[model samples]
Target chain A: DQQVKQNSPSLSVQEGRISILNCDYTNSMFDYFLWYKKYPAEGPTFLISISSIKDKNEDGRFTVFLNKSAKHLSLHIVPSQPGDSAVYFCAARAEGDSSYKLIFGSGTRLLVRP
Target chain B: NAGVTQTPKFRILKIGQSMTLQCTQDMNHNYMYWYRQDPGMGLKLIYYSVGAGITDKGEVPNGYNVSRSTTEDFPLRLELAAPSQTSVYFCASGAVSEQYFGPGTRLTVT
Candidate 1:
């Protein structure tokens, strides 16, 4: 079963606009969430993350909001740029697991039109 | 540092053939993992190692094997390859909550 799900396969937005990517999870045991961005033929790079205790975390133009009761999370990028076009993945880390293993979603491909 | 490195960027094998996928990390991280990504699907863990001489199975470990002989190396073995085994494989190493991944190995079984 897919514990983490990114229902949107792709998204498109205009430059300088807002880009929002959403993700949902079925496992309530997951206490930590992360986002990764990937380009074609390249490995994914860590973007940002939030703990279960925190509802929101922001870094520069990127922000992540978590709604624990809804089992949902979203990544928001304001004034999106062409460089932000890439596949984004949402992952979660389960509690009590020392392995630090992450369960990833299928990924959402974001396209920014300049 | 080299971070994480995987060998044989691409490979094709006939059914029933066997081969080993090599993974090495220079980060000196004690935790390493092997994962496979099918087309249009998310990554699924096959095995993980906490340290040398210790290994454990993950979500999908069938038809695959792994060994952690040293902190820097964790190799994945595929025995009796099948068509269903064709997928892209990735190796990752982490020291804490974050993991660094290699470019990945694309394998096909015909």
Candidate 2:
């Protein structure tokens, strides 16, 4: 069973516009959520993360919002750039797990058109 | 600094063959993990180690084994490889929240 799901397989947006990617989970035990950006032929790189205590976390052009009641989270990138075109993965981790084995979504391929 | 390194970036194996995927990290992290990603599928954890000489199974540890002999090396072994085991494997290491990933190793078993 896929605890985390990214319904959209791909998304396209124009440059200088906002690009939003959505993710949902069924496991309420997950307390920490993270987003990673992956380029072709490279490993996924950590972008930003938020603890369950906080509903929003922002880092430069990227921001993530979490709705615990809905078990949903969304990643927004403002003024999307061509360089931001890549696959984005949303991951969740449960508390008290020292190993931090993250459960990841299938991923959404984001294409920022110039 | 070669944060995390995986050797044999690409490999092709035949059924019943056995091999070890090498992973080494320079961050001196106490935690390490092995994950496999199939096409269009999210990564699934195979095994993990919190420290030297300690290893535990993760979500999908059925066809894999791992050992952590030192702080820097955590190698995954596949015994009697099968076609179903073919996938891209990744190695990660970290301390708190951020995990550094290595360029995945693509293994194809025919």
Candidate 3:
């Protein structure tokens, strides 16, 4: 069963515009959420994260919004740049879990057109 | 600093073959993990180690084994490889959050 899901397989956006990527989860036990960006043939790199206690977290041009009641989270990149094009993965970790393993989503490929 | 390095970036094995994927980290982090990504699928953890000499199974650990003999090395072993086991393996090290990942190793089992 896929606890975390990214419904959109791919997305395209024009440069200097906002790019939004959505993700949803079926497990309420998840408390920590993170977003990672991966380039072709490279490993996923951490972009930003938010604890369940906070609904929003921002870092430079990237911001993540979480809605616990809706079990949904969205990643927004303002003024998207061509360099930002990559596969974005959302991951979650459950609280009080000893193993500390992260459940990952299939990923959404984001393409920023110049 | 060679944060995380994986050897044999690509490999292919016939059924019943066995091999080890090597991973080493210079970050000196206590937490290490092994994850596999299949086509059009998200990554799944195969094993993880919180410290040297300690390891535990993750969501998919049936055909794999791991050993953490030192703080810098965490190697994953595949015994009697199967076609289903073919995928891209990644090694990461961190303290629990903000993991540093290696390039990855692509494996194919026929």
Number of the top candidate by lDDT?
3
DockQ of each: 0.63, 0.69, 0.79
**Which residue segments of model 1 deviate by more than 4 Å?**
none
lDDT of 1 by residue, A30-101 (tens): 999999898877777789999999999999999999999999999999989999999999999898863367
Positional deviation of residue A102's Cα in model 3 after best superposition, in angstroms: 0.3
iRMS of candidate 1, one decimal? 1.5
User: Can you write out model 1's per-residue Cα lDDT over B9-83, one digit (the tens) per residue?
Assistant: 999999999999999999989999998989888888899988999999888999999999999999999999999
Arrange candidates by TM-score, descending. 3, 2, 1
What DockQ would candidate 1 receive versus the native complex? 0.63
lDDT of 2: 0.93
Candidate 2, A25: how far from true, in Å?
A: 0.3
1 or 2: which has the higher DockQ?
A: 2
Q: Cα RMSD (Å) per model?
A: 1.2, 1.0, 0.8
Model number with the top TM-score: 3
Q: What's model 3's lDDT at A111?
A: 99
User: What does candidate 3's lDDT look like per residue over A1-76, in tens digits?
Assistant: 9999999999999999999999999999998899999998888999999889999999999999999999999999
* TM-score, per-candidate, Cα-based: 0.97, 0.98, 0.98
Model 1 chain B lDDT-worst window of ten: B94-103
Clashing pairs in 3: none
Docking class of 3: medium
